[model samples]
Target: MLLETSIGAVIRYKSPVSSKEPEFLILKNRRGSWGFPQGHKEHGESELETLKREVREETGIQFLEIMSFIGTIRYSYMKLNGIRSHKEVKFYFATTPIRDIVISYEHASYRWVSFLSGLNFLAHRQLKSILIKGHRTGLY
Candidate 1:
């Protein structure tokens, strides 16, 4: 039995030139499911470091101020190799000033949407709950 862990951020930002309303950044993966930027942890990497690297790799935006640790979610899935793995993801509430997004090869597209919109776009119940927890943190 093997367990894997990943880290991610519920990134919030408001355009300095546009309206003051905050928007959450969501990425569309190649499978068409939408979620926040995240990736597996590397050797000797802290959760925050993994999150920052994942965000920078998945979305070109960087220099995010980590506000709070939202929470963690765990689930199990079968990989393509027919091995079952348990995965846990730790999410943080982060804010950034950059509005422009340059998606990486891991994702198909990206969107900066309102809180409600982000909740609607998220496919996983855990992720939706994470977004709501992030909202309560007042980071947005």
Candidate 2:
């Protein structure tokens, strides 16, 4: 068994004037599955640095105000080469005012959705649990 670690964020956006609930950013991958922006940590990069870079690369939203680390999610899958691997994803709660996005080739589309909508959009139970933990942080 192999272990892999990645960093990601649940990016929240709220209009300063609208007084509405904060919307979360979700990316639809080429496979048509939705998830947050995340990637493997690069050499010599800290967790936060990796998370920031992943967010910018995927969403083109650079001004991330990282609120706090919510929690970690773990899952297992088999790689293309038939190797079983366990992955751990550390998720942070972040906020950004920018709404415009230039999605990278990795994703087919993107959306800014309400908390409940995000929960509905995500298929993995672990991801939904993480989102709920982030929402419970009282920052939004």
Candidate 3:
């Protein structure tokens, strides 16, 4: 059975954040939708390890450090067999590697948009809450 687990970061730059510069970086998918960079946990890897790996794989950058936890979200989706499986995703507030970046192929484009822009792109209401709370706390 595949129990899917993943992690994401709200990556912020070292520069003073601008309302126009966006507090969050979002990856645009093939579907024309946007989401955070995340990937599956590999064997023997810790959660943080997976988060870093996934972010780098998806966005071509590293996180200097994790500033805070943004909690987790879980939901279920069905496979071809019609048996539903659950995905639990952990999220964190992270600082970037102190360099500008380009994205990898998994995403067609990227945006460093404001919290409101990010919220507009994020498809899930629950993840939006996490992002909002993380922003309010100024965790990054």
What's the CA RMSD for each of the models?
1.5, 1.0, 2.5
Pick out the ten consecutive residues of candidate 1 with the lowest summed lDDT: 14-23
Q: Which tens-of-lDDT digit does each residue in 10-88 have in candidate 1?
A: 9988567566668899999999999999899999999989999999988987788888899999999999999999999
Q: Candidate 1 regions off by >4 Å?
A: 17-19
**Alpha-carbon local distance difference test for all models:** 0.89, 0.91, 0.78
Per-residue alpha-carbon lDDT of candidate 2 for residues 1-140, written as tens digits (9 for 90 to 100):
99999999999885786778779999999989999999999999999999989999998988999989899999999999999999999999888899998999999999999989999999889999999887687756
Considering only N, C-alpha and C atoms within 3 Å, which residue pairs clash in candidate 1?
Answer: none
- Model 1 lDDT at residue 99: 80
| TM-score to true structure, per model | 0.94, 0.96, 0.84
lDDT of 3 by residue, 1-140 (tens): 45798887778765654443545678888877777877788899998888888887877785457777888888888988988889988988887735466788777888887777888888878778878888787674
Where in model 3 is the C-alpha error above 4 Å? 16-22, 80-82, 97-99
